[model samples]
Target: MKRYIKSTIGLCLLSLLFISHKSVNDNTVIKLNSDEFNVLMGHQGSLEGSIKYGPNKGNGFSEKDNDIVYGFTDVNDKITWTVEVPETADYLVAIQYTGKEFQGQTPDCTVEIISNGKVLSTALRGLTQYNESRKVAGTRQWFDEVIPLKKGINTITFHFSEISSKQIKAAKEELDNGIPPKSSASIAVKDIALVRPKVWNAMKVRAKELKPDLSWMRDGKYGLFIHWSLFTYPLYGDKQAFETFEWGVNTFDVDVFADLVAETGASWVTFTTCHGMQMFPAPIKTLEKVLPGRTTERDLIADLAEALNKRDIKLLLYYNMSPRGELAAKLGIEENPDKWFQYLNDFAREVSLRYGKSIAGWGYIDSSFSAYVMNMPWEKYYRSLKAGNPDAVVAISSHWWAQYSPFNDLQTSDSGGSLNNPLDKKLFEEGGRYEGLQEHSSFVLDGSWFPKEPFNGIIRRDSNSKGGPTFSEQEYLDYFHKMAKANVPVTVNMLITQDVTRDQPFVNPKSLEFMKKVKIALGK
Candidate 1:
């Protein structure tokens, strides 16, 4: 038979169990252990089920020694906790839980916070788990939000939903057939806490105060972003390129590329060191050990950095944070939080130590505004970069998590196209730093970032016998002027060929003329 447990810890008992307390003012704070909630088996049909309760502590939470809650596979599973409020006011509600994805898939669970049957917040999907372990629980990972509570007994219900109906049906069938249900999604909750807004606001303020100044990035209004890889030879686009393992980086000419970048009047040039395919152009000891031959024989990044620095143009290194293909296979372990984080730390440290101060900035992708990446020890990774170059400007994709985290120097305002009308300034305000915005513009006629196929006849201006629409000179100049007036730096994503026959990647005379016109118009 399915067993359910209803447990409660009185206010007096909670006071004794309280391990720590943080106060911004006179407002009272309360932390309730997960096992203390009144758990009913199959309570409500829309939200019906019970969780297995035990003292299996993992991710850092205050009630590590005390029993916690887990074994939530049913979609209708609901956990309710009642808190007595002294006054009716808004309080920051923070839930500390551990979420993990299985079999190389994204985390599959939807959670909603409801108060007295009223929805407090929309369901949040794709919640990520930590890749690190903790010895003693002490509030290491939490999902925080502010909600109003009544002065009397208020019930807060956490509703769980599986990502797909197929998974839910399978679990239900197993339970009916007298077999234990197995779930891909596993979330373990430690506790829930309520704190005054003043305390939360004060914490945000302190985080903002620590943000570094990015004036150097702001001063240079335009940048050139080169996204070349071994996949360039196959002419595969971003998504399809990651499947094959090939290193065609030998055909790249750094000096000629650097000269072309200088001609574009771009103040900085960002190169992709490791992209989706998990191929690194430069040698790193950790990468060599984990996935041998995945790296190129020549250190293209170093040579390019030196070449661009000679022209007084800064270099920003692009690192894809997502684990993919052979790299993931070689690592052989992903679910273990401690082991995964150690791998990430080693990779970051090796890259930072090798580049030193030659690179002016670092841009991380795939974690844009993601809670999963936010939960990782990103502060340690950022520190790794700073240890090598104290003045390095660190930023991430704007579309990813924009909240104030100490890990990044700035947040990109990438709106996906040439137009810069929609600017995201909330990241700067939330993080307590201001580093303008990073916008992307494409130079291709069809606006594709990379070539789709080999010699597809779009690389050169005169080779357009297969005629397609191309951006006019005026259009390019207008974009530059608009971003310049708005004080937002634009990074033009240029497609370079590995054809070896071309003198330079930007061989299209028409596109080259337009770039020169932009330089003249911007008075660079």
Candidate 2:
């Protein structure tokens, strides 16, 4: 049976209700109901909504009669309540609310907690109400924070900020364009309680324990990451101008590329499907409908997956979640964040289903840290990927190691620089459910991912001026050995060159030679 903790009324009222009850201590729980609290609406010339009360049956709330307070959509709305404290000390504040979503789309609600007019904490909460019919249920989640209280009556105020009109307009425009409407944010407050620190710690520990296992990632020691796009081509003028899709996609050769990957002796290769300025290669129908003539005619992902499978090399696809530069502006992502996010999810679903088991994993970049990208329903996207291919491992680029572990299969660090020290495996093990480390290392002798000039059809050993400086064989072996010792896998980035006339794409000859020497040094 689940344990339930009740609240304490007051010292004077306690004697009349329960004379035989024990004295309240630091670990005591104090719960406040919505109907009994003071409500302040329209703080700064904002419109006011309504207060709703219902049977608190869902989201772990067992209270009855007027337990929920909701319908405040203005950004300046506030809910204030007073609680009588027995002593001055630290307490854990846990708010229980019901979040509703539509078809797996949800909105964000940010609540700022103020005690005696001083701000204590601000939490951005997600409310998704996708029902059980979708094989995923949107239920209640708890947000807990540590707060200090003084003896006597302490007034705590909760400030609510709803989604802006601009965001809602964007979602409506996307709906008109035949895209499913993302979820909107609404909250039904069941109860607000203050508990001991031990209770809060227990809840955190339970969340960590429920994370998915990622042992397969740890077993794969070294992998190759290819970041090729329009930027791979030579730029004559400003060097910062965006290259056209026609020039970059027309020269890619999957067969020659797969053969070189087989010779590297690496277990896996991650291909950048879409970057900031270009979509490398895709045949998804959704993308074709949304943005015409932007993708490659050849389905490089499918051909590469098939070729790598024969050589026992796994294929991991990389997609940048937060895109910038000219390509993003052309797609009108800046005008409507929700519209672009809907398109992104649709594209992810299409590709994940089309490739299925042939694709071993996915690496999502630039979302975990960006506030705009975090506002979207990324959990639904992750779920969509898993729905298509359950065996595939998913990871996100997050500086906080375990921040995405609850939703993703692994975590990635794009903090790439000179390879010198070993990664702290212990740091990655702390907050996440996964059990591996992923670090990026670049091989351009100049320490850049792309070369300044194009290699003119010849495979030269000393093309440092054309491409970047290639890593020495010893440098590759030493870095691999260091990663292996710490059980951390490294995805080394290598530059690529293309022959437009012959329709050929190949790795830089110097880098390829370095990889072969490293393979021999590893005795593979």
Candidate 3:
């Protein structure tokens, strides 16, 4: 339900943008030539060219399908790709490529655009790479750039100059002296292209003209919170004993769910390590030994970390701070809150040690605990996580943790009724609805888990959780903008079910349409 709602909202925003610019399509024409492309505008034209690679064997550059051969900075040898483009769009030109390399120490290459035997533009292309400086990985990457293009027949040349033997000796010396190599191929360049879009192509110009502030999210605004656990192992109730809530490693479709969460464009995602109804394979010796069917079959947390990292999504570990957990009932520690807290703290320690790099923060599931104890060790635990990762954020759910503590980044507000704007004087007093309050928190917290229908009355204690407000695309856009304007950030939870799966009710065509509309309103 949340997924469908989010998709619908995204598509609606997209449709609105396309509809508004429907007539603009008539103002431009695109033509592809052998080695070049053209975008004709009403008053100006744009031209693009393909990038040619050098011979692999000569300069240690291989002819492999996707190898980016470097070590070239010499004269007499140049790798060139030529193109013929009409004049006029010289002020706007761009070069783009998809590459994957570990390091970026390769010497930069220069690009020359010649039109009618005169140099129209000359620019330098630099090497860019991903991963840590000392240690790098072989990952696929993509990047694009914009450059100025001149009219009439044009020739674009990529000159790869080979490095002299003396420089190579120096590079070797730098490495031998326990220093890092100064010259390293940052990435493998897969393909390169030049692009020039005609019509309201004011994006580059506008960006250059107006300096917009883009640092709002230095502190995160919205994030994706996933509530999954052993409960998913058996569809809520599918066990022989059925004595305690069902839990097993087979409950979740981890990969599918990860992709689903990524599609929502969430900057951060939080997953429930364990819930009230299930016992996860937490690293507590006693707990792991006592828990039934707690197999070491699969590592869900590791899979989640990899998935989120692939999409550059921040990972937030959601853990229950209290509760013997469902398994604790069988272990005879179900009512012993003291040992339960100790076990939870140990579990948190293991998580911080194992997956600390992948985790951006810790979202403590506010369970039942004494006020003083909740504030005491839990606060220290949060501090310990910060010691592991200085940039990590922390959130707590219990009463003391929520109320009288600076150990939390977001205050978990479990308001029972509908979302309402407290700043609205008249509407707020009259109990009438106001804007911006319709969106609920998507953060991981106690009772924030999406409840299965036939949701016991205790689960949906808050009236808002039951038959909550349904929003249209416009509503989402409006709410998003209003929050931005008011300097308030919120995580909107758009519930989704397996039946819907983003294409529900005769294929949820409305979701995309709504997303399109929202994008326009947000001006994103």
Cα-based lDDT for every prediction: 0.50, 0.50, 0.37
Candidate 3 matches the true fold with a TM-score of 0.43
- Superposition error at 182 for model 3 (Å): 64
Return whichever of 1 and 2 wins on TM-score: 1
Could you give candidate 3's per-residue lDDT for residues 117-153 as a string of tens digits? Answer: 3332232233333222332222111122334444533
Model 2 lowest lDDT segment of ten: 37-46
lDDT string for model 1 (193-274, tens) is: 4456674555445445545566655566778766664445332223323344333456566778888888878888877666
Q: Which sections of candidate 1 miss by over 4 Å?
A: 1-91, 94-212, 234-247, 367-374, 398-401, 424-427, 431-446, 456-470, 499-507
Q: Sort the predicted structures by TM-score, highest score first.
A: 1, 2, 3
Sliding window of 10 residues with minimal summed lDDT for model 3? 1-10
Candidate 3: C-alpha RMSD to true structure equals 26.1
Model 1: lowest-lDDT 10 consecutive positions: 36-45
What lDDT would candidate 1 get against the real structure? Answer: 0.50
Q: Return the clash pairs for model 1, or none.
A: 61-137, 131-337, 368-400, 368-401, 369-400, 369-401
Best model number under TM-score: 1
